[model samples]
Target chain A: MQDLLFYFFAVLTLIFGFLVVVNPFTRSPVTSAMFLVLSIISMSGLFVMLHAFFLAAIQILVYSGAVIVLFLFVIMLMDLKEEARSTFQGIRLTFSLLLAGLFATVLIGVVLTSGLGAEPVVLTLEGSTAVLGERLFNAYIIPFEILSVLLLVGMVGVVLLSKKNLN
Target chain B: MVGLEHYLVVSILLFSIGALGVMLRRNLLVIYMGLEMMLNAANLALVAFSRFNDNINGQILVFFIITVAAAEVAVGLALIVALYRRRRTTDVRELTDLKL
Candidate 1:
């Protein structure tokens, strides 16, 4: 039941994540952004299976919803050259791929050796929103307030930076 | 057979794919998306570990991470837009005028 759902979403996550990186058809960022949508949505699914329902909704709302739309808007805003959009053309391609491979090997090896997947412990708590909110508003209240301020600062900074010169 | 390690494997692969995109892709937008992918990979691992460990803190951390990421993208895209306005190109290679 849950195992099958896990595999399904896991496979989808990897496939779309790969496509976001190295899609063979077109090098357009728009296509990559679409694939990113698939990847994020599946990731939220994994979160749900893990019983982090609140975070799962946030993942969908904040990530797949707001973040991806922002990416798409920027893609449409940018004027890209079709001929210049192609990636991995010459020697750098091979070198980059090699490095990427080496990185994957090292991390995957560590994760495999750790045997984390061997122990399938059943969870006692569902990690529901109310529980999360209790902890958040109690112990994590200060940081939560600070985060709001940070978001506000970021909004102001972006507007000022992107605005055309007034003087 | 799915377990914590299985989820970790998927997360790690996701991170690797993102790293490749960042290294190989020329388009700035793709690079940005790759960075986001890497962030997401981290988020996935956090949630998985939190789940298996029977904790909620990891999810809260992921919450902060996503918030920060949204702010980051806003600023980063704004910078990219400003740069594009001045140079009219999104290729990183051509934007190396500061290179001495």
Candidate 2:
């Protein structure tokens, strides 16, 4: 049951994802952006199936709900063109496809060969959350703090980039 | 068998698609969206791994990742806007002024 739904949504998400990447040629960023939002929502459903309930909610709320809206807004504001003369043309396209294929094959091979024969060490739902919280607030505290700094830097950079330089 | 490995394979395919998008697209915004796709692909892998390993750490890391990704998109779009304002184009071809 769960597996069936997972496959269904995964296929849906993949289709929309394909649409998004090919969207530049469609001459409508708005349509691409809408498909992207739908894809994100479908991914959130996958998260729920994984039993990461909190993460699922956050995925929908943050990604599908907020970030996508921002993307749509940006798409609306920008004056998109046909983009016929791009710097990254034929050879680059072929090379990228090749590189992506190589890396994906290698990673997939490694994962498959590893043989996940050992039964998973299941942690209780409540206990798992508690441990996660502890690690975030304690062991990974520095990265947490650094993430905040990163946000600050991004904020400052955006402001500086947007603001008119009074020369 | 449609188990954890199946999910991982699907996730890998998605990541590859994103990689292709980033590699081929000349538009910075499209590249950024490709980057987002890669991130989401990894997030799916993380959650799937967490479920298989019966750990929640992956999910928590995913939480932090999402936060950072949101911030990234925010700033990236802003930079695109600023770049557009100065150059009137978002094509990477026209960005040669700074490269030279």
Candidate 3:
């Protein structure tokens, strides 16, 4: 049962993710954004399978709920039309694909040959919310505080950048 | 039974696809989405390793990563929007004013 569920979500994730990148049917950014939402949801399913329940919920809320909506809002605000299909230069496209393929080959080769371990170890600690919160507030308190400051800076910077006339 | 390698392989493939999108797409928004995909791929790998290693730290790192990603997307989209307003197009090939 678990194996079947894993395969289902995994395939869904890859498929939607692919659509986000290279949808043959449409060149609209909105379609890609929507596909990205589906991909993110399926990834959260994989997170749940890994027993990181808190991360799964956070992934759904933060990613699909907030982030993708932001993308849609921007897309709507921009009123972007479907991109022309001929934008892809043949040589550049070929080079990009070749480079990406090379990267994936190297990484996958390292992963397969690293021989970390085939057998799954029994998880002694599940990533429940309470434990994650404790760790965040305890061991990682400084970084957490810094992250908040970074977010504040990001917010201010965004507002400044979006202003029509910076006086 | 899905092992860590299975999860890692998925993560690798997703990252590769994201990289391809970033390279292949002309629209800046699509490129940004590709960046998000790449980040999510890294997050998946971290969670998988966390589970197999029986450590919560990797998950904790993912939490930080997600927060950072949220901020990045907000700022990045604003930049894209601002650029669009000035340039009136989202095609990367045309935004070459900085090219030397």
Native interface contacts kept by each candidate, as a fraction: 0.86, 0.57, 0.85
Write down the worst ten-residue block by lDDT for model 2 chain B.
B1-10
Highest TM-score among the candidates is held by which one?
Answer: 3
- lDDT string for model 1 (A19-129, tens) is 998877787788899999999999889988888899889989998898889888887887787635444688888998899889888988998897776766777767689
User: How does candidate 1 fare on TM-score?
Assistant: 0.95
Leading candidate by lDDT: 3
Task: Give per-residue CA lDDT, model 2, range A74-155, as digits (tens).
Answer: 8778778766645445788779879999989998998788876345455444324566668789888998999999989988
Give RMSD to native, each candidate: 1.5, 3.1, 1.2
Task: List where candidate 3 sits over 4 angstroms from the true fold.
Answer: none
Better of 1 and 2 by TM-score: 1
- Candidate 1 docking class: high
lDDT of 3 by residue, B1-100 (tens): 7788889989999999999999999899999999999999999999999999988999999999999999999999999989899889998989999999
Q: What is the TM-score (0 to 1) of chain A in model 2? A: 0.74
Ranking by lDDT: 3, 1, 2
Q: lDDT of model 1 at residue B25?
A: 82
Can you list the residue pairs that collide in candidate 3? none
List candidate 1 segments past 4 Å from native: A83-86
After superposition, the stretches of candidate 2 with alpha carbons farther than 4 Å from their true spots are A85-89, A117-153, B98-100
